[model samples]
Target: VYVETGTGELVPASLQRAQPALLEIPASLDAYLKSIGDKSRNMIRKARKLGYEFRRLTPEMLGQDIYEIRTSDPMRQGRPIP
Candidate 1:
């Protein structure tokens, strides 16, 4: 058996097939949050209350952080790096 999946409905039509799903990209973060609704908002708020935070990495920290995460167990298990 074989299976394939990807974005863009037009690509499948070129091959005489139809994609099972359509992708939608939100215009902004606010649009994304509104689409997911209140439950997700509450969960994010609770996580923040518990001291979790998210932000972009500083240039000085980027290399070390990327190397650490790429070598970590979770990333290795998901897909081994050559």
Candidate 2:
């Protein structure tokens, strides 16, 4: 009654067609930094020292920001719609 594609390769085939992209979540910040390696860790530390705050934005918050970014493009020639 139901079919699911891209969920994962539930059954193995002689010629496999697709595999889902899997994201691994780190248990802690130390684990995340270790996964990314030293250079990326240093860069992230520097960004934080420079007062950069990384966060998630809701759709409501992104709506106006997205519109502004899209319309601010000089190549669009004053057209608000992309």
* Candidate that would win on TM-score: 2
lDDT of each: 0.75, 0.77
Off by over 4 Å in 2: 1-16, 74-81
Listed in order, each prediction's TM-score against the native is 0.41, 0.63
**Candidate 1 residues 6-67, lDDT tens each?**
55333322443666687799999788889996999999889999999998878677888877
Model 1 pairs in collision? none
lDDT tens digits by residue: candidate 2, 1-71: 33345975455446446887899999998888888978998898899999999889787889988878876
> Number of clashing pairs, model 1?
0
Q: Estimate candidate 2's alpha-carbon lDDT, on a 0 to 1 scale.
A: 0.77
Off by over 4 Å in 1: 1-36, 58-60, 72-75
Clashes of 2: 0
